[model samples]
Target: MNEVLDDPVSQTMIDIHCHVLPETDDGSVSLEESVEMCRMAAADGIKTIVATPHLFDGVHPPPSRDDIRRKIDLVMEASGGVVEIVPGGETRYSHEIFQEARDKHTRIRLNGSSYMLLEFDFMMVPPNIEMTIFQILQAGLTPVIAHPERNARIQLKPEILVGLIERGAYAQIDAGSLLGSFGKECETSVKQILRAGLAHFLASDGHHQDRRRPLLSKAVSIAAEIGGERYAKALVEDNPLALIQDRGIPFQPEPDLAALRGRAKKKAAKSWYAFWR
Candidate 1:
């Protein structure tokens, strides 16, 4: 006898980070743009997208939870239910963020799970990043470092990311970085992270319909080329779905130290040359 059972929800592609919430941050401009972003994501085979708007309390205040819900509802309706939108925030590292998530006073989580998207400044990793990661873990939430490859500090010191991953945090690679949209450094660092098996998720980090658009499908092939087919599939699907469902992610590969050291040396040499120039 063949008993077949499958949950469609569990077998869908999930984008853990995106900036598609209209008027929330620097993502989509209006409700129309948000709907269009969702449409684009659905067309590109993304079944779920976490609208992770920039959430910096004093710097870039995010929309209220109710407001975010309204926008998501609007976009979901506009997308004709082809895609699912969830409220989340791309929170910059701060000492107070963990408590904020614990209180449930805001949407700091990825779809109300313990998995939170933590972003750093594009230029540098904060001096207290290690302490902050500790704090997040203490609060019983897993911090998913958003786009470490794009940070200049991580690009210069790739080992810093290895340390972060070792400290029990996951790293999410941006699809744009894989496609060399940002620059060579970002692309190289992302490949190194993937090759080393340190990267846990791949997201679009989408902003608008055109430039920073949602193109996660393209990253799947690149991830396979760099990290093998299984790791690439997990990056886009399995791992992200686990976070969404509040379950343990099934895949966590050991980091390749030899590859990390090679990337570190190359990055160091590049930085030293730029300094002399």
Candidate 2:
């Protein structure tokens, strides 16, 4: 497990959507694979990352948070602090799905650290989408919308995101989407999110070793190009730190989406709540 430990930048980036745990879901299938991914993330200049395994109805059968932490401890022992894996999970948005996740032990929270990461179905918009978001917020946790840009229905109606933002929902685009790594539509939509300023957080949503490899460096570059390095750093670094520490994340937006998206085209992570049931 202690294969690679010479991670140089132990003070820079904090990846928001890495799945470095083994076998809980579609992340690294084993502990050794998770270690390798951590090494790769460390090489890519990430200092810290959340191990957001999939917490959905279809995949994992709701693992315990204690179990999740035990695995993280294993990875921590293996990596020797080269990369720290915290307890978090990429949760699917369904009261039913979340009910299943409540049995889980390690559930990843939102960037604000007030809520958890939550993803909806990509094939169609969730029923009562806005109301569901409100319910999540009413539950005393921030509602982070995971990769809304990839959702086909939202893509057709970009203005939906404006409403989401107006109602206090935070939107995060997948790291791969920023790089156009998902597909042309995801690429175009990411551009729109950036231009519209709809995206508040950027995450890797990484699941595998090859194409889905952890690359905060690339996202940093894009953020620099589109929204200055300091701003990018806030989403990947400061904001994330505040989240894990359970601190309030102040919203200081630069480009306003309601005004910005009036002339632009795109769209938008949440988790944790599924496991607390």
Candidate 3:
């Protein structure tokens, strides 16, 4: 079990992306598991957790707003309110998203805010991703890209994510990735993203209480090493809290695209040299 950090910042942590709702998707398997997950989150100092189940992923049918709310209520009650669980979904990129975005009462939006957690395929970024993000923005919702560092395409070319951030989409790095839970490639990409100021939020895209646990202290410490304590706190605390409140992110910084590009070029050159040598 990961011990909660002693820092004051961890006490008010807000996890904007977590899958803890019972039988909602591939998250907590049952109501008991949901309660346990909430306990785990609270122990780790997560005061609030947005229960983001998978949505419009072509696998599970879209859960109705009432169903999500009911599940949230159940978990909150069962856990004795150990942690505040808000309603949200990790919506996959699809044509159906535009329609949901247009709806005033769309359940997919995070905590009924204009922010939405947008997910893409793991293997590739869609070719029409820019246009899709534009449409979502036009619908008055900010798309927070979930775990771009885990994407194969972004791992190979992080500047692609820079373009999306430039296009007004925010990037969220998974806590697990920072701790090398996803592997070295993901860890490298996440560090590069943070160093270049490309990430706006850090969250536990936590699915299980044990495997991908809902803990952020360890990862936040790692982020503090890479980008200072203030910048790291903004990712897990200030920024995400602002997001759930439907306010502008207080810590967004312009990504250093020039620096990122230069690094990419150097890495390519090094790879070429190693190949020849």
Candidate 4:
């Protein structure tokens, strides 16, 4: 059993998605920055952090599994074990993902668990996304969609994510989104997702120690107001711990799909009425 499981109070928060690996991508730029980010996370009550650098984003070359593992060790050593750092990647959606799934790529999985942190384009959902998710599931891995609330397409039609959740995919909301760092549209969408119980994890997509620093307490407070304390805590603590352990999310509640659909229709009707006015 994970040590955290033995002492729930000690491991009160676990961040499953973060870009804390120095120089791996666009996250922490140097070893000093990575160590600072770890300290920030530990100070914010995050006991465990999955260092998810970007992968297959057409920007940085994908870090090898050994590279990721080695970087994690470096960060952990530099940080003096302030927080437990684990290997993972914020994998961009691509045809290559299918092959990765088939091979059960450990580097892309969170802490080499069955859970993969999947990222889509910010402006659009990928073509045949449901089928893609199905393929990932069929390969015996769960795709945890990262920051769906910030996606332009999902913002316009929140119910689109409901369908993905129903298809066995989980959603992770960025801590910054909850704190309104992404703007009003993202904040509103994240609240709707939380209230409807569509969000399965709350992660700090922290890229730097100062700007998008690793923190979850502020967001968890806002989430508690939107979905109550139990659900809010589950997003950052129980759910994430379960994910890294390759276990089913213990706090998952049936998403209120009907509510999301209804709200979308109402918004559409209002937009149409305003168009004529």
Name the top lDDT candidate: 3
Instruction: List, residue by residue over 1-277, the lDDT tens digit for candidate 1.
Output: 0011122223258999998877877789987888777767776778889888887745667677788788889887766766788878888877568658677545788888888899887888888778888888887788999999999888777889988888889999999999999989789889988998989999999999988897698888999998899999999999999999989888998988898888677767978999999
Q: Rank by lDDT, highest first.
A: 3, 4, 1, 2
lDDT of 3 by residue, 1-277 (tens): 1233233234589999999988888888999888888777777778999989999999988789999999999999888887889999999999889889879889989999999999999999999999988989999999999999999999989989988988989999999999999999899899999999999999998888778988888998999999899999899889999999999989987788776787789889989999999
Candidate 4 residues lying further than 4 Å off, grouped into runs, are: 1-11
How far residue 228's Cα lies from its native spot in candidate 2, in Å, is: 2.0
TM-score for all models, in order of appearance: 0.91, 0.84, 0.94, 0.93
By TM-score, how accurate is candidate 3? Answer: 0.94
By TM-score rank, best first, the candidates go 3, 4, 1, 2
lDDT for each candidate structure:
0.83, 0.71, 0.90, 0.89
lDDT of 4 at 252: 88
Comparing candidate 3 with candidate 4, which one achieves the higher lDDT?
3
User: Which residue window of length 10 is worst by lDDT in model 3?
Assistant: 1-10
Report residue 175 deviation for candidate 2 (angstroms): 1.3
Which digits, one per residue and each the tens of the lDDT, describe model 4 over residues 148-181?
Answer: 9999999888878988998999999999999989
